[model samples]
Every structure is written in C-alpha cells, then in structure tokens.
Target: MSDILVLYYSQGGAVRDMAQLIARGIDSVPDMRARLRTVPKVSANCEATEPEIPATGAPYVELKDLEECVGLALGSPTRFGNMAAPMKYFLDGTTSLWLKGALIGKPAAVFTSTGSQHGGNESTLLTMMLPLLHHGMLIVGLPYSEPALASTTSGGTPYGASHIGGASDDRPITEDERKLCIALGKRLAITAAKLVA
Candidate 1:
C-alpha cells in the first residue's frame, strides 16, 4: 500500500480534525493509506528543544516521510492570511529534498483553518502551494463539481479545504467543510495511485 501523508500543524484542533477527515477519504481508496504526521513548534529561544516525541497528537514529521509518501495532504491554521510560522519553518528545512527533487511529480493538496470567515483561508492554501510547486509536485484542488464548494457558507473553497474556527478558535467543522476535506483527500489519493500505476 502507498501512504499519502496527511501532514499538518493545527493550533486549535480544527485543522487536525480536518486532517483526520481527509485521511478517512484517502483510506477509502484501494491501495492507498494515510500517514498522519505533525511538526513541533519553532522555539523563540533558539536553544530550546522539543521533546523527542510529542506528548499528544501524531508523531513529529521527519525528512524521510517526504520520500516515503506517494502523495501529501498538507494542512495548517491560518495566520495573517498565510500558514502558521511552525509549518513554514518546517518547509524551510526541506532543502535537501529539493536538491534531489525527491518530491517531483507527486500529487499534493492544501487545507487550513482560519479564525474568521474572511480570514485568510484561500490565501493560506495558495501560499502553502509555493514550496510544493518548487518541488515539482502536481497541485490538486477541489473542482467546481464538488457541490460543497458552491454551497458551503463557512469554509470550503476551490483552492482547497478550509474551516472557519471563529475568533476564539472554538468553532467546529461544519458538515460541508468536513465533506470537502474528505473529497479533496479522496481525489488526491486516487490521483496518486493512478500516477503510480
């Protein structure tokens, strides 16, 4: 089975929940499985270190995860219309992967959770694609055919899956948002499998 990495950095649990939904969709496809992973926070004190294993959530991502995965579904919480700093910090460290073009032609998609409806969901997804593009990955996005894109009042978008987590990050993922996340994941997994075939 090929593993499609569901990689994310979620602050309020909303994005993490979205990742789980996406993983479910990926697993629904034959010959595909989801590998969930996360990144540790970047310390303000340069000398500070994170525990070898995170106390909660998925294990921290390692560089090898990139080479081992057939596809990627990346997620993060939106910060100022862009991905959180932790996710960006992690991506900045992947130069070795870029040097070898290890991710070339792999299928990839993005997702994010924002504090408000007008918050940077689309921009976050868009910005998140830059590094993937640099790696020569094929960008996967939700097409207009997905009914939720047209109907979702709270987060689904053509750019990728998204959720409005409210000002205090207390909002739950709406049914429409959940469905779109799954659809994106399924689409990504199926596409990856086809590419491999």
Candidate 2:
C-alpha cells in the first residue's frame, strides 16, 4: 500500500480537524493509506525544546516520513498570511531530503485555518506551496469542479481547504469545509496512485 502523509501544525484545533478530514479523503482510494503527523510547537527561547514526543495529538514528524510517503498533504494555521512557525521550522530541517530530491515528482497539497473570513487562508495555502514547489513536488489543488469550492461560506478555497475559526479560534469546520478537505486528499491520493502505477 502507498501512504500519503498528512502533515500539519495547528494551534486552535481547526487545522487538525481539517487534516483528519483530508486523511479520510485520502483513504477513500483503494490501496492508499494516510499517515498523520504533526510538528512540535516552537518556543520563543531558542534554548527551550519540546519533549521527544508530544504529550497529546499526533507524534512529531520525522524526516523519514517525507522520504517514505508517496504523496503529501501539508496544513497549518495561518500566521499573518504565512504558515505557522512550527511548520516552517519543520520544513527548514528538510535540506537533506531536498538535496536528495526525495520528494521530487510526488503529488502534494496544502491547507490552512484562519481567525477571520479574510484572515489569510488563501495566502497561507499558497505560501505553503512554495516549499513544495522547490522540492519538485507536483502541487494539487481543489478544482472548481468540487461544489464546495463554489458553495462554501466558511473556508474552502481553490488554493486548498481552509477553515474560518472566528476571533476566538473556536469555530468548527463546516460541512462544506470538511468536504473540500476530503476532496483535496482524495485528489492527491488518486494522483499519487496514478503516478505510482
């Protein structure tokens, strides 16, 4: 079976929920499986370090995860129109994989969550694609054919799946948002399967 890595960093749980939805979508394809992983939180003090394993949620991602996966679905909460620091920090450590072209030609997609309606969800998804582009991965997106892209009042986007988490960051993912997330994952998995075959 081929694995699609669903890697994400979420502060308010919205992105995490989206990641799970995406995983479900990936698993919809025959012979495809989802591998969920997350990054450790970043600390202000450079000397501070997180435990070897997280206390809860998914385990911290390892570089081996990238090397082994057939496809990738990256997600993060928006941080001023960019990916969160933890996710960025994790990507920064991927130079070894970059040098080896470990991710080249693999299918990839992005997702995000934001505080407001215009809280940089699209920008964050776009920005998240930049690194994948540099890695020579094929970027996948939710096409307009997905009805959720046109109908979502909360968080689906052509760039990728997203969520509007309100000011307090407590809003749950809407049905449309969830559908888009699954669509994005299924799309990536299907693309990966085709490419692998």
Candidate 3:
C-alpha cells in the first residue's frame, strides 16, 4: 500500500482533528493509507528541548516520512495569518529533502485552523503552499466542484480545507468543514494513486 503523510502541528486540537478526517478520506481509497505525524513544539527560550516523544497525539515527524510518502497533507493552526511555529520549524529543517528532490512530483495539499472566521485560514493555507511549490510537489486543492466549498459558512476554501476554531479555540469542526477535509484527502489520495499506478 502507498502512504500519504498527514503532517500537522495543532495547538488547540482543531487542526489535528481535521488531519484525522482527511486521513479517513484517504484510507477510503483502495491501496492507500495515511501516515499521521505531528511536529514538536518550538522552544521560546531558544535552548530548551522537547522530549523525543510527545505526551500524547501523533509522534513527531521525521524527514524520512517526507521521502517515503506518495502524497502529503500538511495542516497547522494559524498564527497571525501564518503557519504555526512548530510546523515552520519542522519545514525549515527539510533542506536535505529539498536538495535531493525528495518530494518532487508528489501530490500535496494543505489545511489550517483559525481562531476566527477572518483569522487568515486561507492565507495560512496559501503560504504553506509556497514551500511545497519550491520542493516541486504538485499542489492539490479543493475544487469548487466540491459542494462543501460553496455551501460552507464555517470553513471551506478552494485553497484547502479549514476550520474556524473560535477565539478560545473551542468550536468544533462544522459538518461542511468535515466534508471538505474528507474531500481534500480523497482528492490527494486519488491523485497519488494515479501517479503511482
């Protein structure tokens, strides 16, 4: 079976929940599976170190995961209209993969969770694409063809799947947002399958 790496960094659990929904969508396809992984948190002190394994949730990501996956679904919570620091820290360490073209030609997608409706979910998704584009991966986005994109009042975008987590990051993923996450996952998995076949 081929694997689609679902890599994310979620502060309030919203992005992580979205990642799981996307993984379910990917696994719905024959011969495709999801490899869920998370990044370690960045240290503000600049000298502190996180434990090798997290207390809970997915394990920290490794560069080998990127090299081995047939496709990618990158998700993170939004921070000032950008990706969270942990995800960025992890991506910044992928120069070795970039040098070897490890992700080139693979299908990839992005997702994000924002604290508010106007809190930059789309921009975070778009900005996240910039590095993947540089890595030569093909970006797969949720098309308008996905009905949820047009009907979603909570969170769904042509750029990617998203969720509005509220200011306290307590809101649950809406039905529309959930569907779009699944759709995006299926889309990425299907595209990866075609390429592999």
Candidate 4:
C-alpha cells in the first residue's frame, strides 16, 4: 500500500480532528494508507524547547516522511490569516527537500481552522500551498461538485477543507466540513495513486 502523509499543527484540537477525518478518507481508498504526523509547537523563548517526543498525539514529522509519502495533506490553525508559526517553521526547514526537488510531482492539499467564518480559512489554506508549490508539488483542491461546498454554512471551500472554530475555539466541525475534508483526502489519494502508477 502507498502512504499519504497527513501532516498538521493544531493547537485547539480542531485542526487535529480534521486531520483524522482526512486520514480516514485516505485510508478508505484501495491500497492507500494514512501516516499521521504533527509538528512541534514553536516557542517565543529561543531557549525553550519541546520534548523529543510529544506527550501524546502523532509524532513530530521528519524529513524522511516527506521524502517517502506518495501524497500530502497539510493542516494548521490560522494565525492572523496565515499558517501558525510552528507549521511554517517546519516547512521552512524543508529547504533541503526543496533543493533536491524531493516533493516534486507529488499531490498536496491544504486545510485550516479559523476563529470565525471569515477568519482566514481560505487565506490560510492558500498561503499553506505556496511552500508546497515552491517544492513543485501538484496542488489538489476540492471541487464544487462536492455538495457540502454549496451547503456549508460553517467551513468548506473549493480551495480546501476548513473549519470555523469560533472565537473561543469551541465550535465543532460541521457535517459539511467533515464531508469536504474526507473528500479532499480521498481525491488527493486517488490522484497520487494514479500519478505513481
């Protein structure tokens, strides 16, 4: 079975839940498996550091994961309409991969959770794609054909999957958002499988 990397940096747990949903979708496809991973939180104090292993949740992503995965689904909570610093920090360290064109031709998709309906869901997803694009990966996105995209009052977009987590990070992923996230993952997995075939 081919592996698809489902990498994410989530603070409030909403993005993490979305990642799991996406992984489920990827795993649903024949001969495809989801490899869940997460980035460590970035600290403002230069001397501060996270433990080598997280106390819980997915492992810290390694460069090898990027090198080995057939496809990628990236997720993060929005920080002022952009990806959070931790996720960006992790991507910044991928210069070695970029130099070698390691991610070239692979399928990639982005997802994000924001504080409100207009709180940078689409913008965050768009910005997250830039680095993947720079790495020469093909961007995979949701299509309007997904009924949830048209019906979602919460968070669903053609750009990618998204969630409106509310100001207090309390809102749940709506049914439409859940469906779209799964659809994006399934679509990305299928595309990657076809490319490698």
Candidate 5:
C-alpha cells in the first residue's frame, strides 16, 4: 500500500482531529494508507528545545516523510489568518527537499481549524498551499460537487477542508466539516495514485 502523509501541528487538538479524519478518508481508498505525523511546537525562548519524541499524538515529521509519501495532507490551526508558527517553521526547514525537487508532481491537500467564522480559514489554507506549490505539488481542492461544501454552516471550502473551533477551541467537527475532510483525503489519494500510475 502507498502512504499519504498526514502532517499537522495542533495546539488545542482540533487540527489533530481534522488530520485523523483526513487520514481516514485516504485509507478508505484501496491500497492507500495514512502516515500520521506532527511538528514540534516552536519554543518562545531561543534556548528551549522539544524532546526527540512528542509526549502524545503523532510523532514529529521528518523530511523523509515528504519524499516517501505518495501524497500529502497538511493541517494546522489558524494564527492571525496564517498557519501556526510551528508548521511554518517546519516548512521553512525543507529547503533541502525543495532543492532536490523531491516533491515535484506529487498531489497535496490542506486543512485547518479556526476560532471563528472569519478567522482566516480560507487565507490560512491558501497560504499553506504556497510552500507545497513551490515544491511542485499539484493542489487538490474540494469541488462544489461535494454536497457538504454547499450545505456547511460551519466550515468547508473549495480551497480545502476546514473547521470552526469556537473561541475556546472546544467545538466538535460538524458533520459537513467531517465529510469534507474525508473527501479531501480521498480525492488526494486518488489523484496521487493516478499520477504515479
């Protein structure tokens, strides 16, 4: 089975849940599996360091995960309409992969969780695609055909999947949001499989 990397950074856990939902969608495609990974939190203090392994949730992502995966599903929480600092920090370190054209022709997708209706979910998703695009990834988005994209009262977008996690970050993934996440994953896997075939 080929693996699709589900890489994400989560502070309050909503993004992590979205990652899992996307992975489930990827795994639903035959012969496709999800490789869940996370990035370490960036320390505010320059001297502080994260452990080699995280205390819980997905393991830290390595550059190798990017080269080895058939596709990618990137997720993060919105920070002022942008991806969280840790995720951006991790992406910034992938120059070596970029130099080698390691991700060229691969299919990619993005997902995010935000604190409110206009909390930059779309902007964050669009910005997250920039790095992937620079790596030569083919962006896969949720088309209007997905009924949830039209009916969603909470979060869903053609740019990708998203969730509105309330002010306290306690809101559960709505039914539409869940469906969109899975659809994005499935769509990415299928696109990658076709590209590699």
Candidate 6:
C-alpha cells in the first residue's frame, strides 16, 4: 500500500490533532495510508537531548520517512509566522535527502495551527512550502472548490489547512477547519496516487 507521511510538530496537541484528521482523510482513499510521525523538541542548549523515541504521540521522524513516502503532509504549530523550531530543525537535517533528490516529483501539502485569527497562519503555510519547493516536490493546496475555504471564520486557507488553536492553545479544531484538513489530505493522496500510476 502507498503511504503518505503525516509529519508534524505540535506543542499543545492542536497540530497533532490536525495531523490525525489529515491521516484519516488520506487513509479513506483507495490504495493509500497515513504514516503519522513527529519531530523531537529542539533544545536551547546544544547539549540537551531528547530520547530516541518519544514517550507518547507519534514517534520521532527519520530521514527514511521522507524518502519512502508517496506523499507528505507537513504540519506545525505556528511560531512567529513560521514553522516551529523542532520542525525546522528536522527539515534542516534533510540535506542528505536533498542531495539525492529523494523527494523530487513527490506530492506535498502543508498545515499549521495558530493561536489567534490573525496569527500568521497563511504566512506560516507559505514559509513551510519553501523547503519542499527546493526539494522539487509538487505542492498541493486546497482549491476554492472546497467550501470550507469560503465559510471558515476560524482557520482555513488556500495555502493549505490551518486551525485557530486559541490563545491558551485549548480550542478544538472547528468543523470547517476539520473539513479543509481532510480535503487537503484527500487531495494530496489522490494526486500522489495518480502521479505514481
């Protein structure tokens, strides 16, 4: 079966929840499945370390995950209009894959969780796409055909999918936001399946 890597970094569980929803969408498609993964937290001190395996949630992602997947669903909690440090740190380590052109021609999509309505969700999505672009991956986005893009007051964007995670990071993903995340995943899966064929 073909698998799409649902890779994410979530602090307050918002992005993780979004990842799970996206995985569901991907798995709903024929001949596709989701491989959920997360990155370890980066340390302020270079000497600090995380365990090889996380205590809970998705296990830490390996570079092989990127090379093996048919598609990628990258998600992160927003940090000053960019992906969080852990996710960025993980992406920065992908030079080996980049040199090998391992991700080239694969389908990819981005998602994010932000603390407020205007909390840089779109910008974060755009920023997240840059590295994928450099890797020569085909970027997939939620088209206007997805009704949630028109109606969502909380979080949904053409750049990708987003969730208004709330100031305290306690809010649940809204219905429209959930639908858009699912749509984005399904779109990526369908496109990847077609491209592989």
TM-scores, in order shown? 0.97, 0.97, 0.97, 0.98, 0.97, 0.98
User: Per-residue lDDT tens digits of candidate 6, residues 1-197?
Assistant: 99999999888999999999999999999999999999888787532168889888898899999999999999999999999988888898899999999999999999999999999999999999999999999999999999999999899999999999889899989999999999999999999999989
Off by over 4 Å in 5: 45-48
For residues 1-197, what per-residue lDDT tens digits would candidate 4 score against the true structure?
A: 99999999988999999999999999999999999999888787422168989999999999999999999999999999999988888898899999999999999999999999899999999999999999999999999999999999999889899999999888888999999999999999999999999
List candidate 2 segments past 4 Å from native. 45-48
TM-score of 6: 0.98
Q: Residue-wise lDDT of candidate 1 within 40-154, one digit each (tens)?
A: 7777643215787999889999999989999999999998999988889989889999999999999999999999989999999999999999999999999999999999999
Runs off by more than 4 Å, candidate 3: 45-49
lDDT of 2 by residue, 1-197 (tens): 99999999888788898999999999999999999999988786532267988889888899999999999999999999999888898898899999999999999999998999999999999999999999999999989999988988999888889999998889878899989999999999999999999
Q: Give the RMSD in angstroms, all C-alphas superposed, for model 3.
A: 1.1
Residues 1-197, candidate 5: write the lDDT tens digits.
99999999998999999999999999999889999999987776432268989888789999999999999999999999999888998898899999999999999999999999999999999999999999999999999999999999999999999999999999999999999999999999999889878
Task: Quantify all predictions' global Cα lDDT against the true fold.
Answer: 0.94, 0.93, 0.93, 0.94, 0.94, 0.94
Spell out the clash pairs found in candidate 3: none
Error of 3 at 183 (Å): 0.5
